[model samples]
Target: MYRAPRGTSDILPREQAYWRYIEQKVVNACQLYGYERIDAPAFEDTKLFSRSVGEDTDIVEKQMYTFEDRGGNKITLRPEGTAPVCRAYLEHGLHNLPQPVKLYYIASIFRYERPQAGRYRQHYQFGFEAIGDDDPALDAEVIDMAWQFFQSLNLRHLSLQLNSIGCKKCRPGYLAILKDYYASHTRDLCSDCKTRLKRNPLRLLDCKKPQCQQIANSAPRSIDYLCPQCDEHFNRVKRYLELLDLPFAVNHRLVRGLDYYTRTVFEIQPEVEGAQTTLGGGGRYDDLIEELGGKPTPALGFAAGIERIILNLKKQNVPIPPLPRPQVFIAHIGDKARDEAIKLAAALRKNGIGVIEAIGNKSLKAQLRQANTLGAHHTVIIGEQEVKTGTVILRDMTTAQQRTIPIVQLQEELR
Candidate 1:
């Protein structure tokens, strides 16, 4: 038997409660924020990601699942959400409709990586994007939405780590200073950080290795080197966040993994000691639209791993509302009763009642046991006598008390 590929697992029936819960919360949150839903293809041209997410980023350089299609075109499974949303925004002329197009998506993201707890090769993500505007207030709204989303989940002890990585203009200067500082620590740098120093210096601060983190800690802070415009933008974003009373801290080493990020970058993570799990994060990507051949458009977005959220929910012992299941089961004792049970099942379903009819000739006792196991609220028994009399026996699964009722009254009795 073939198993699911490495780094992937089946989301079994018993696991759906968590998924449904998170999905409902996601939909409700988006609706409250006026974010309409948008979905993009599972895969896109390989160049789309390389262009928008940056050539040197791990997503493009290492993790992306790129392959040639039948047409011999290079295609890549989407490794992230924001680029695809931006692509759709540009392709569909959404920019023509309004100044800011607020959109949300729940999509499966694929990457070739070593899977760990709560991380998978093909995992689902819930993300929302606000494209076509650059107001600091909008940034705050996006961050606030992210923070409040976790709050709505009732996940406790989450910290919002905020930072400004400066825009393209001032970032180069910061990178120069950063590279100069790391120049002396070349021997102490990790092999990856050594390469990052050459290709993507900002990612050095994002390094997790102990020694690299120490080097990043003492490195030049990006916010300190922001240009005048970026400085003002950072300040206003803070003021707006403060106005909303969001608890946030300025983390100097909080540069996000994406190259498109600029100015305000932030992440929300659980506050457990020695644990660095980020529930979600996003920041301003002011240059990405123009980079993708569209006119200059400032956009920002936040994405959280559904698996990670479910993991955290389980960790916190949060309660999840179970998905609705069949509440009534119909059991039969004979062929005539089986036919009647089928008809009754259909009638109940048509009347908007959920009923599970017995299948494949089970004993009445066995059928009732199945109903009890399924947590059915009531079981309707249609034996030969009941079918002849046009009546049914309804048993309360919880109380074990049963009564004979006319077939027409079954719906009302179940209700």
Candidate 2:
């Protein structure tokens, strides 16, 4: 049998309630944070990411699914949400009206990376972005939205990991220090790190290799070298979080995998592991709008993978929507009763009562057996005896008791 492509997953009925719950929480949180919902395409021009997400980033460099379209224009399935949001911001000229256009999208983003636990090639993301302002308060607000989202889900053991990847002013100075530090230890670096040292030293700190991680500990911190303005912004963001009683940690090594992020970067992960660990993560991208050919807009947002969040809910063994009860299973004995049973079922349905029926049954006993297997609470049985008398037999499947009721009063009697 044909099956779904590798690294992709189908969300089936049994596990779908968790997705509904997560979507609800995210939508509700977005509403509370004053972020209007917006939708962009699943794919766009390949240059969108190359410009916004960065040429050196893993998503742009290797993971993107790009191809030439019919007219020979290069297009790509969006590997992330920010670039598309920025594209929309410019295409629709939203920057014309608002100071900061706050938007959010629940989208399925694509990638070509090796799939791992809680990760997929075609994964869903809950993303948000605020453009047009460089205010630190907005940074704190976006972070709070993510934090409160976890809290709303009753998710425990989550750590608020925050950092500031400085802007152009101070970033160069930090890069200088980082390059000098890494250049001295070139012989100890991995091939990838050695190459990154020249292109983007910040990426070297983002490597997951343990050998690379060790070398990165000695690299420069953006927090230390932030320009006066960026430093003030980062500090104010901290002050806001503190004032709101939201706890966060400074992970200097958390150089978010994207180059667009500036001044604020963060991730929300379950402090507990063994299953429900990284629920979702996102950070600020202050330069993305400008990179996408719009005004130099400051933005901060995050996206969570639906699969991982649902898996985390499963690990906690959360209860979901209960099975619905079928109020009546209509059973008919002869062809005449079967005709009338159809009318009865429709009438019952019109009254908002749940009804299940198997028509033209061979025997009353057989029909009743089917009703029991279906877990029907009440069985509406129309045999020759009841049909000829303008009455019906209502059997309480739960109590095994039977009573005759007039056809017109069947609904009222059941109620």
Candidate 3:
């Protein structure tokens, strides 16, 4: 039998409630922060990510699903959200409208990676992007927003890891220092780190291989070599986070894997044991817009993996709000009653009553069973007699008590 491709899973009906809950919570948080919703195409010109995400990063180099289209354009399913949002910002002249365009999106992101417990090839991301601002407060606000999102879900033991990877002014010096430091230990570095050192030395700091990680932990930190301006920006971001009463730890080794990031980078990680898993993260990609052919604009944003959020929620056993049940179920016994049932359901719906119709079931017992399964507040029973009398029996599923009512008053009775 054919199955869903690897690293992808179906979001069945039973699991939809959780997904909806996350979407609603994230959207509410975005609205609370005065962010408008914006959506971009599912795929874009392959060069969009190649330049914005960085040519040397794993996302653009390997993970992106790039292919030629019928018109011979190099297209790629978005590997991440921020780039596309930035592309839209530049394309639609959002920069012309406002200094900083605050936007949020709950979008599907694709990455061809090994499937793990909560990691998938195709996952949904709740992302927030604020473009055209360089205020350190924006950095803290974005961090606070991400913290508030996880807290809104009632997640526990979350820790914020913050760092500064400097900017163009001071980063080149840091890279030289990092290269020199890694040069002596080249024999011990992983093959990827070796190549990373030659091309993008900062990437060596984010290598996941155990040997590379060991070397990376002892390697020179970017924060130590930050330019005077970058140092002040980093300090202000931390101060703002503290002013907001958001606790964060300084992780010198926390260089975000994106090329667009500058000055401040961070991740919100769950404090669980075993392998560390980041719930979500993003940093100040101040140069991304300019790199993608737009005028120079400073922007910051964060994105959380919805699948990982759901996993953590389940792991913590946090109570998820149950899906709403039908207020009334319409069960019919005969052809005439089924017809009446349909009409009654439609009328009740028009009047703002939630109704479920089980007209296909011929037996009353079966219809009531389906009503009970649906957790309907009331089951409206119609038979040949009731149809002829222009009435329905409204059964309260919760109490298993029912009473006959005139069809004309059905709306009021159910309400």
Candidate 4:
């Protein structure tokens, strides 16, 4: 039998309630922060990510699903959300309308990576972006919004890891220092870190290999070398976060694995036993807009993996609101009863009553069983006698008590 491809899984009906709960909570939080929703194309010109996400990053270099279309254009399914949103901002001239365009999106992102427990080839992301502003307060606000979203879900033991990767001015100097430091320990570095040392030295800091991770932990920190402006910006962002009562730790080794990120970088991870998984992360990509051919615009954003959040919720045994139960089930026993049941079901639905029908089930016992399985509040029974008398029996499934009412009064009675 054919099956879903590797790194992907079907989101069956049984699991949809959890998704809806997360989406609704995210939407409500975005609204609370004055962030309007925006959606960009699922795929875009391959150059969009190559330029914005950075050429050396794993997402652009390996993970992106790139292909040539019928038009001979290099297109790629979006590996991440922020780049496409920024492309939309530049394409639509959002820069002219406002100083900072605040937007949020719950979108599907594609990445060709190993399908692990909370990771997938096709995943959903809840992302928020604020473009055209350089205020440190914007950085704090974006982090605050992410925190509030998790708080809304009642996710426990979430800790924020914060860092500063500096900007163009101070970063080059830091890279020089980092390269020199890594040069002395070249023999101990992983193969990837060796290449990173020559290409993008900062990436070495985020390497997951145990040896590289150990070296990174002792490496020189970017915060200590931040330019005056970057230092002040980082300090203000922390001060704002404290003012908002959001706690975070300065993780010197937390260099986000993106080329465009400058200054503030952070990740949110739950303190779980055995391999702490990051729920989400993002940073200030102040130069991304300009790199993508738009005028210079300082932007900051964050994205959370919906799948990871759901897994954490399940792990914590957090309660998710149950799906709505059908209020009325229409069961018919004869041809005339089936016809009458269809009409009654329509009328009840039009009047804002939730109705489920089992007109195909000829046996009343089977029909009642189906209603019980659905946890319906009430079951409407129509038979030859009821059809002839223009009446129907409404059974309260919970109490197992039923009563006959005139067909004309059924709608009002259900309400």
Candidate 1 residue-wise lDDT, 304-389, digit = tens? 99998888888889998888999999999998999898889999999999999888878888998899899999999999999889
The residue ranges of model 4 lying beyond 4 angstroms of the native Cα positions read 208-211, 274-276
What is the Å distance of residue 347 in model 1 from its true position? 0.7
Rank all candidate structures by their lDDT, best first, as comma-separated numbers.
1, 4, 3, 2
Lowest summed-lDDT stretch of 10 residues in model 3?
Answer: 270-279
User: Which lDDT tens digits does candidate 3 get at residues 322-384?
Assistant: 888777888988888888988888888888888889956558888888888888888888999
Every model's TM-score? 0.97, 0.89, 0.95, 0.97
**lDDT of all the models against the reference?**
0.91, 0.84, 0.89, 0.91
Clashing pairs in 2: 157-271
Q: State the lDDT of candidate 4 residue by residue for 12-128, as single tens digits.
A: 999999999999999999899989999899999999989888887889889999999999999999999999999889888999877789999999999999887888999999999
RMSD of 2: 2.8
Off by over 4 Å in 2: 209-211, 273-277, 323-328, 351-354, 359-379, 392-403, 413-415
